[model samples]
Target: DELQAQKAAIQRETDLADESPEAQAIQEAKSEVDSNNKTSTTHIDSEKEPSAEEIAIAQTAVKAEARNHDLANPSASGEDTKSKSETETEKLAAAAKAKKDRINNNNEVASNTKNLMQEEAIKASNNSDVPNLVTNLNQSQASD
Candidate 1:
């Protein structure tokens, strides 16, 4: 690094004295190189900064590309944060759905239990009394 910097410093000093033969040859070579570069590369745009309209058009093009992707895949409704392979979010959603289904199933089981146990009928028969139930069961057993 030091050697390259020293060389650059020496070259700068030589170039500052424009009367030197080395400096003249270097300037000529530099101009030739620049001209050759300009002719060889025609794909480069001369504009350094894009205008506001151009920037807007470029942004629109990008949005259209993303919109095209969404149109093709209707499931991708919102912003895509990851690929199909990176499915952590999808896994979480699936687990939540399964949990919801399980909860619904449990609710159905509870509803079925109300019919299976005949709790309402038993409660209606008892009428909040305890001694009556015991006596009834004892008499039913005695008769049997």
Candidate 2:
């Protein structure tokens, strides 16, 4: 009979996820006590979630750790420290810049490779064998 009543009460509430005061009253009333604890029936209260401040602190800590890691290993790419909700214009600009960057980067790599190959070819062509001065030295066991 108690279970049936609880079911009917929950049915009346309709949305269990609703956290408004009136909904909470309905939910609290429907909350059942453990069968083992027959001495008294107690409402089941869920553990409260972390506050905004707590969430901010956690976010800050994670950002700090990432900043430290980036600092320790300095790489070619630079990352932003702050998180922002990008506007539509900013997003489109970023996308365009990324495409332009890819093209430029490929060209830069090819140019660098060509310059390096030319320098190596020039060095190889200029090879004039200079005689080892040590070979012309006397090999006698006498004192210097």
lDDT for each residue of candidate 2 in 70-123, tens digit (9 for 90 to 100): 755655235554236456668889999998787567988668766777744334
Q: The CA-based lDDT of model 1 is what? A: 0.78
For model 1, where is the 10-residue window of minimal lDDT? 121-130
Off by over 4 Å in 1: 1-86, 108-144
TM-score of 1: 0.21
User: What is the per-residue lDDT of model 1 for residues 59-115, given as tens digits with 9 covering 90 to 100?
Assistant: 999889988777657676557657776698789899999987876679787677667
TM-scores across all candidates? 0.21, 0.18
Question: Which regions in candidate 2 have their CA more than 4 angstroms from the true location?
Answer: 1-46, 71-144
